[model samples]
Target: MKQANSGALVVFGLVLIAGLGGALLARGALYLGMHEGDTLHLLDMALRMGLHGQWPHLDFMTPIGILAIAPIAGLVAMGLGIGTAILWAQVLVALVLLLPLVRMAGSRFGGLWSYVMLGYGVVLCLALVHGLANPAPSVSMHYNRWAWAIVYVVLPLALLPDRGRARPYLDGALIGLGVGALVLIKVTYAAALGPGILVALLVRREWRVLVVAVVAGCAVLAVMTALGGSGFWVAYLTDLLTVAQSETRPAPGGIDFADAVAGPANMPSSILALAVVVLLRMTGRKAEGLALLVLAPGLFYVTWQNFGNDPQWLLLLGAAVFALLRTDQPDSRHAGRLHDAMKIAGVAALALTASSAVNIAYSPIRHLFAEAGNTVPLLSALAGQDDIRVAEKRLYKVDAGVPLDGVGQPFAAYHDRADRKELSRLKGEVLPACELSTGYNAMFETIAADLEAQGHAGSAVLTADLLGSLWMFGDLKPLKGGAPWYYGGAPGLAAADLVVVPLCPTTEKSRATILAALEKSGWRFDELRRTDVYILLRPVRP
Candidate 1:
């Protein structure tokens, strides 16, 4: 009892320090702007879903995040400005949802291992880091990330070493529902730690409990499908398949072996630690112990799936510790050593988390400093050149590993180190193109096109990209101002008297197709100077 109490105190201290440090760093430096790519597009869809009282799903090709995720993010944005509120909200939510899992584990394991599991697990670690720095931290994208932690990671720990008096089936079902909810939010999450949960449940011989969970999940899904239409099923399947492809498919930025090995190594030492527990379980050690051996693999698989060292990985550690803590056998002499080992691990995990928090907090500033330091010296040396523009031109021409070149040009590309290399490769390549007249795009373009089709052509025509600068265009504003759905399709092409596209090959294909369609409809293309983006024109109808 004395050792357990001591372990609890140490564990609490470490988690507190890690959590507090992460929260403070995230609050200070990270800005909340959505870029033009994945995060922006996902949030844009979420906003529309919230406004219209429609839940987004991946039907046909429309991208819709999970149900709980989108609304939570949309509500947060509504209450606080979208950019500033999102990052904080994500961290708070991850903590709120995860702390319970840790406490539950502590209740079962003794405080020592529960703390280590919660603190050092890959899911929790990754999420804490990701929450602090990632540009978009809306629950929409990261919701499943957390769900995986709770369902596969934490819930399994909770189930093992059951006290016999507790509500096992109900608890398991609720945990399953949480996982199901994650699947609904982002189809990508359907695979995230799901198989692991199944494996754990089976090993525990909780087959009846599993049945209850499945039934409850099926019932909820049925209700949703009935209310939402066939589009719901179609979208769900589409999202699931797409997510599977993305995970399994090789991309330039796919798997990194070093990240895999280094991430989970600190917490657990050997298969022996796990092996002893399993042997004891089968050798009448503890029922919970035997169940845990199966559960551990699921947790590892989930953590391994997220190769980028995201903060969500911490939850996996939390789950593992929870499992360990629950296995405390009072008669075993090794309990004292286990308690001491866990305390040391907890302390070390806390220190690592603190360092991680600092690294994430200063990442942007570090990048900015590195870029500025190099540029300042060269500018000073070139200060005396007669043609300042010439010096500037020369400086701009230097390949900065970005698509945008030339000094003083509008819409100059900001090179993001994270995606620049891959994005540059994708620049000229034709993608698996999204046609303008389908899914959400269809809905958006239809509304915009209706305005033009009904002789509202004189209204200011604009695309989603120009939404922020709506005031700059003309007196005419979007029927649904700043709604991104209408930004890319036939509506975006036809609503405006002028069109401008980037000069990249992808843009060229889109621009060419759009222009050809417009000319076929008797509209004339008045070519405007096109750079990386686009510019096109048509005569006023008399």
Candidate 2:
């Protein structure tokens, strides 16, 4: 008993070191490799929530739950530099989750498996980059990483029986807090795995676990409600429905639901899961088999819902498959085959997910080297802080897009042959058939400076761009009730004094979508001015 306890402590100690050391390796700075737009979106929301004391859903609009940005916002509110706040917030989150991780990992796993499970949680918490093995580092969809970490901590406790003693209270409470955190971080995760967790506990007759998890989850909800109010939930649901119903909000990189499940990239893990489910049932591990049967679709759903469609669940699935092997009966002749098959499946699953796992674990090490490139500060608003920097080319290089043939060309008959979506129109005004790419920080800072120079400083501006982050760049006041990223609707129109319409947007369809929604909502506006940069309009009382 002493040896095992000490082993768990050693594994946890390694996890703590890996987490804190990795974060501190950045030297209190955050260097981003890609996804400046997404980073700007996060910073905009954090400043709004922190400096302006805005509440998500109440004072602004976003599908992302407040908890996703609140910790960083709180730190920024305390006058911490944004990049420093991000790194330390990660450290804070790791420390906060350490106990839950200890309870879950210590109770359920033994040997190296404990390290794999808990270390992965630390990686999810502390990694500077969001997962996609080969891609450059980014903080984009970081909440998804956090949500997956919570899922890791929860599902293990829910599915696996304890190694030493079954303390249902500790397990259930942790599971509850995890799921609750998932809901508050990214609702898609909870919506994905919450049912499977409940059923797994039910099938195992772990009534205490189930009841306590429900109570704990509700306790989290109650606390959030007491802090924000019931309307917060309604607004959260509204934001979710907006995304669910919007055609533009599908999984990015053109990955649809079927693609997430059966696409070339996902096929291996999907096959491994199916084979393992069959093997688990064949080996008389019916409860776990049923759980996986239910879990596979949920995993696919979350992958499809997330921006990158990363199959991060594969590692956990692989871990669970290996763990299930220990539960098999020794008498069956097929036990040998089941063990062999589980081993192969588990190993293959891990192999498939290995690149991304390694990528996540190696992010901070990569961050240290990211400074080798010619870099510039991420935002001029936080300029001179020098804590957040990006590659020079990613900011200065702009891609405004190439148009198809004009009136007298070969493809002229095709008429604006772009991608899948058509060029958008707003209130009978056709937007240009072009899109902006890269140069997010440069673009926002330039436009914000121009607006300030034109005597619009401190004015609340609503931008008909993919992100409403003009406030992040200059003296403009943060939109009191606007979305940082447009997920549809005229989100902050009520608080917007001027609407700035970009001719060439980073995401043309999204820009068109927002403009159309604002027009459709009957927002009365008078065209104030037009420039090479943008068309400005002032909202008028109808």
Candidate 3:
């Protein structure tokens, strides 16, 4: 009891430090890197839910589980500005996971490992940058980070023997809650880790834990269903399937699954994981070894499927190595040699993944020091959100590229070899093969202002591009049934009053895909207005 209590105290101290740092970040403006588009997507969804009393899958189309944005939305609902809400949401997640972290870490981990378990928990919850080592501090895919923290908490509880007396109910509840949280945050993580977790409990004969996890998961589902109504499940699944079947983003960021698993950058981590599995098996811990083996493929899939495909799994793998090292299996043979090998593997795993872990840990500090003079407010019309800023160059510089394929152009000579194809024809109007590379912040604000000027201030817009975020900038309503970020299908089309087609879209493929879907659906539009920037059309509703 003393040990657990002392360890819990250490966790609180670490969490308090992170909490103070998060408050500082909330006070200062945030400067994001390489993910303004994703940031905007999150901000838009959060605002839709917060300001409009809306819900995902009911009011909008998205595969992302509500828990991803609900905490931030909850903060926004409580009258905090968007910028502060985002920062504080991280702190809130860390605080929410405190009980599980303390319980799991204190009961299972010893000395340095106990501190490590709790410390990483705080990092995962309060991290300003989504961890991959290329840290410039941005709040994007933060749910993934939160899910990982829950994974860390649950993993040790399921895998290791408790240092103290067994408390299956407490352990079971934590496991169940963690898994349920994962399901509600992002089902992909839950799907990936589910089998391994179940297998671990089954192999270890932790039937109580297994039953409790399932019941708790179902309870979470029941609670959400009651809140969002029974239709929520069907709509949520539909949105997920739509994204899964999307032709535009078959694998996020065009990642090669094989490469992500065994490529030069990730090969070492893969090898280290396999070695640990073999070492564990040889030392009379086949169940632990087997669970890790099952976890390996899921880990790889998640790394590849996520945008940027950062190998954040390495930290988890490192934790696994240390946890196994701390355990004693009396029936083991060749224990000395294999245990030494395990120590080497643990060190190697942590060393390889150290940069990413360090980067995530330091992000709040990095965000606190971002220069304000060189940046402008992220949203132009959001009155009190000046605390979220973007670099002037990223926000205001308009740049687009169209392939050179004219009668007299140099590329015309090699047209056959160029693999050139005209994009999509929208209502018999051919869109050029053009892409808007920068100035998205400007694009949304400009279109919103223009639409408001033309007496379309409060209309719901469905952009024929990758994003439909004009509502964030001016007097427009977020489409009642829109996808914050397009993932195939005409999600918000029927609910939209107008369609804004940018001349140079952020993603040409998305533009072409959306237009093709519209054409197949036989949707017709009346040209309301046209300008150098966009074509505004009113959909002829059935």
Candidate 4:
């Protein structure tokens, strides 16, 4: 017994180190590569709330959860730069979410195979971290991966037959917490998993466990709702309905079973294979059968929601491999064949993951670390100096030499080295503006200057192409309550003194609508400036 305890401790330490180390390494790599995208905007909004006590409106269209952004906000409030704050927050989250799984795996497998299971967990963490930094079609920083990881961790424990007397309570609490967190992060995802978990509990007839889980989950929801206020509920429900009704938004669709079973990553095929293994095990192993049965509904939900890009499928693959590898009766012919098939599927999944990683070689871990040795010092030097005007002037001078792309350009491509002079320039002048500009520094500055010259700097400016840039660069507030898209059919058009619409192929319809509205309102329109990208417009005198 003493030896078993010691072995568990050793494995725990190793797994903790690997998981935490991998997370931090991934964070550092992403930071060095200057990889910022969708999530950063969410973080920015959270930071504003935390730092300035400015909460987003209840009707705000974006659907990010408050809990996911809160930690980043907390980190930033503690005087960490945004990059450093995000790094630490992500690492902490990864550890919190993964450590329980390691403990459970070690407790169940209890040997070298236990170590392999923990290693598998570490790889998944690394894969998620990689996705966060360099998002691809198959892997990205989305809620689904995290939700599925929790599912993978909880389902095994839920299915284990010999969890002892106290384990049901503990497992129930853990599931409650995990699912609660997922619920706060994404309610729709929570809705998907909830039915499966409830049905599983009912099948097992674990009334006490079900009660504990339900109570704990409700408590979490109540607390979060209290903190977020009543407005948050309104916002959440509104967003949910809006997303469901909107044709532009991606909605969950029915899964093609044949396609899933023959998918390239072997995820779907492995799941089907695992189902067969579970049935075979039922002949002699009731515990394994029950476990698979409990896990089946959630797994099916994940497979159905698999839109070919989500990394959640990998979690399913990992779970199947773990089950196959750990199943006893290795000498049985059926078991041996099942094990072999699982091995092949596991190898295929690993290969596909490796291929995806290689395809994003631009943000390789080694390169990021090596480059960080140069960039970190510069980042340090620029810290603690927050002067917006100096940064704006520098941004105005630093041109990209080409017109701005709607999607921001990569910062690394623009500034390769953090030489002392370059660092000083960034620190004393441009860094503040660069942070806000998001690769649109030069263009935003030009537009802002033109707006100022035309006496419309502080006006509620309506922009077609430059959405956030109007406020971020030109000190112009958006004319409408929501995003620019809302302004297309918005009631008050004549209220806006200046309207800047890019006369491009993409904006032709919107531009025509604005023109028609202007003509209808008896407000004469004159072109203020015509650039290759935008046609700035202003109202003529009545």
Across residues 1-542, which tens digit of lDDT does each residue of candidate 2 receive?
A: 11136356556756675645665554667888788888888888787887778888788778888889999999988988888888777777777776677666667776677777778887788777677776476788888887887888898888877777778887888888888888888898888888888888988899998999899999999999999999999989998888777766665657768877888988777888888888888877888888878878888888887777778888988877766675445557667766788898888888888888999888876776676468777876754345788888888887788466646767776765533465677667877777887777667877888888889988999998778888878888888778888877787888888999887788887888888787787768788778777888898756
Question: 63 in model 3: Cα distance from truth in Å?
Answer: 1.0
TM-score of each: 0.54, 0.94, 0.95, 0.66
Better by TM-score, candidate 4 or 2: 2
Off by over 4 Å in 3: 1-26, 326-333
Off by over 4 Å in 4: 1-40, 54-59, 116-145, 162-166, 251-308, 319-321, 324-500, 503-532, 535-542
On lDDT, the stronger of 2 and 3 is: 3
lDDT of 4 by residue, 1-542 (tens): 01124356456645664544554455342333332223334433544545545444352344556665666667778876555555555556557765666555544444454554554444443332333224322123434445555665665555543322346676677778777887766665577667656765666677777788877788888897788787777866766665555433333333354444445644554455465446436435454455555455455555554444334444344444554454465457576666665566566554545544343323323423433232222111123312111122333333322222212644544443433222111112321111122333455546666777767767866554313334444446544333323223322345566766543322233344444445566666677777754567676657
Looking at candidate 1, the ten consecutive residues that score lowest on lDDT are 381-390
Instruction: Report the candidate with higher TM-score, 1 versus 2.
Output: 2
* 146 Cα displacement, candidate 1 (Å): 3.4
Measured on C-alpha atoms, candidate 4 has an lDDT of: 0.49
The per-residue C-alpha lDDT of model 4 at residue 508 equals 33
For TM-score, candidate 3 versus 4, the one ahead is 3
Off by over 4 Å in 2: 1-3, 6-11, 18-26, 327-331, 383-386, 408-410, 416-422
* Candidate 3's TM-score: 0.95
lDDT tens per residue, model 3, 264-309: 8778888888888888887778898888888788877887878777
Error of 1 at 26 (Å): 14
